[model samples]
Target: MRRGLMAWDPQEVPASALADRLARLRAELAREGVDVFVAYTNIARGGSVWWLTGFTPYWNEGLLYAPAQGEMVFATALSKRVAEWISSVMPAGEVTTTPRPSAFIGEHIARDGAKRIGILELDDFPAGHAQAILQAAPGVELVDVTEAFARARNDSDAVERLLLTKADALAQAACGAVDVSSAHARDFIAPAESVARLGGAEECFTLVAGDLRSSRAFVRTDSMGSLGETFAARVSLAYKGAWTRHVRSFAKDAGVQQSMDRAHAALMDFSLQSGETLAQAVARTFGSLGEVNNWVAEQPRGSYPLAPVANMAESAQGFTASAPFVLDVELVTDGRRWVGARMIGL
Candidate 1:
């Protein structure tokens, strides 16, 4: 049903901030010879839309079409019922609602006289929708510009950092709410949900595992599982345009705790050391711990936002001192000592 307890501050990102973000994107598009930039979003990728427009679509899917020089138009599949809310944040005249969203978007593209267009998430965009845009703008050159936008979104602004700090605190609260004594996996869900909602989280994704024998992967607690002397909980919460995740575990054995201690040290050292890209740190760490599983050891340290879930195995080349990131360590050794997990933002 409904579970977010924390209400978002009614205050929205200032108009000037949004304008500056858009202006930066438009400038990037111009450098790429891209006439129009299309940003697509669904519930999962809602942060991308909010990054530029400061409005997160509640129920329906939407996108924004920003030309090199002109007003940005927001189009959605939702009707006027929710359209009003979108207009409140953006330009009312630029908001469009239609059952045939492709045709509506295509018509706008044609009107803008955009030929060299770049569509974010072009590979994932619906085939029917792509066809409609192709039909509207005959011989249009649509490029996949997701990487360009991702680059811009990599670093957080001052406003984003503030929001992320709040989100991180909310995640910590959610993790603290879990009661390992409860035994039942489902028992933790209600408390976690309550904490997140109270923290004004727009979304809460909670997973729990009571299995203690081996390191249990976090799973949605649709059905209860036994605690078996150990348990693990992972909670991810989204507030505003930022997300924070916390992972906690309880172990009855000292060996498991020791393993976790070692992993934590390595993770902290790797995360804090400056100058190494995520990929380099992973390789160096794996090389040092030759006996450890590279798959498990090298993962859990990667980029934040733009890809909220860390691609542990993937090597990230660029390293920025001020950019924010989430560092996690989930370790299992020789199938004997298993520590659940832990996450922190840096």
Candidate 2:
């Protein structure tokens, strides 16, 4: 469940922005000859729904039904007591609370006589929901419109970029709040989460690599004792439905700290040029600093908030120069392992 603040700030996200996004998706559905487009959203997979409707479920699951024209309908199992809150924050559609959300959506489809229904991430959609839809509208063709949705949402808009920048700033501030003098991993996690929550984050996840020398694996455990010679913390934060991650490394040794600082500087200066792959960008920026062991670029795709789009050893897929992405880099500088991550492309 989300522990932080969850309120719609019209100043941050104007209603016009949400309307524009819905219009784009509707255009895509029309092009595909789909009568309606349905997107499923749970706590884990709600990025697409959030992008289109500006509504991220704090808990439970829901289905967004967007007909070729007219306003969309959001059907959820959440209690009616919270319906007004959801409607207030969600500026794009009608909110309908039902015990059987999928069946409600299916009934709507049948009423409309929709012949071709488009579903986002159909393979991952709940089977119960699919069965309910089929039961309501038998023989209605269900088309997987994940790719079509991607085409509609592939580009990053100015409002989203601004929100990403704010989210990244929150992550950075949260990471910076960690007390380097702290003795335990839990100590580091505390300040980071506190800062993020105070900054109005919808959700905050803090991961720690207690000892970079022994391991570079970041985990969400408080069992570790004492900070090693070098430690790293990664803060993933969501603000107003926009998510971004920031990772920082800490070291007791002056030289190690300097190396980590230099690595971060290079990351801040890094940018993907025209026609350059993510690997090429990483090489250009960090090759001089150290041996680039690994790097991964992630972006919001399908229902995932941070889906991997590229890595150091492979070709990038669905990478766009205009879209924002988060990049994590791991490298060895003078035999010391250093890992850092930040938002790229603004």
Candidate 3:
């Protein structure tokens, strides 16, 4: 089980270096018998949309059409100059602009009207937008190719791996910052004690945020200043693109260390028992009710999910962090030495 978890690469990711993901997607599309990879409208924080088209959306929606068999193209609500700039990098066959992504998609679907069209990031699609795509071709089969895109897009491509490496290097440099800065000045580099040392964030000004999928955990600490209180967290592991980041924020208190010790132990224990790959653990915990306890919660309600923390170590380190010990807060995929816990200052 654990054999496969460490096999995955824990590559870092940058906002840039998302371009080559298309080639990988094209290959997956061919394997899966997809005709056209339709990337409609929104290019949220994920960076896949811009990778597909080289143009990021400011506010409106757009479309990306990548034929598994032929040239790639994109349509968006942008000026010709911006579109040309995007096309210059990716070498698209066509770059069409429209006020809305679904409208552009409807137009293109009307042109090809193929039997099956692949759609990525449909979660971002509004109900109104989905109807427009249906109207494009009544007989057309709209397949939910989001996972296919995720697999292809998230697979270790050359360029993306490079970006991941760059991100990792930046983090590594940050990790060493403690050596350069004095103890008093360590806050500029990172907090010396607390969770900063334990599988922590690298930057001094690190932040954590999540949306509908993970906003609860983020909001608990960020929105409500409540810490050290019990809280409940809901995380869906089945998600591929959902993201959450962590900052090693610990209030000045003794309990922080105690909570950190227990959290670390729990992380180790769960990893050992799972006897699964990163993929397997993900398949199991995703959409499942995995409980987290032992540490103080950032929320007055519950603890943050640990699926990310366990998954990342299992995904990157291969060994369990707190195997055969305690079970608390299963990380969905971000790390917090004490990121999830706010010390109940005594």
Q: List lDDT for all candidates, in order.
A: 0.63, 0.89, 0.40
Tell me the number of clashing residue pairs for each predicted model: 7, 0, 30
Residue 189 miss distance in model 3 (angstroms): 12
Best by lDDT: 2
- Candidate 2 weakest lDDT stretch, 10 residues: 312-321
TM-score ranking, high to low: 2, 1, 3
TM-score per candidate: 0.81, 0.97, 0.51
The regions of model 1 sitting more than 4 angstroms off are 1-12, 89-93, 252-270, 277-314, 317-322, 333-346
> In model 2, how many backbone clashes occur?
0
Better of 1 and 3 by TM-score: 1
Model 3 ranges with Cα > 4 A deviation: 1-24, 41-47, 50-55, 79-81, 85-94, 121-124, 136-138, 168-217, 220-244, 253-337, 340-346
Task: Give the candidate order by descending lDDT.
Answer: 2, 1, 3
The local distance difference test score of model 2 is 0.89
The segments of candidate 2 whose C-alpha lies over 4 angstroms from its true place after superposition are none
lDDT head-to-head 1 vs 3, winner: 1
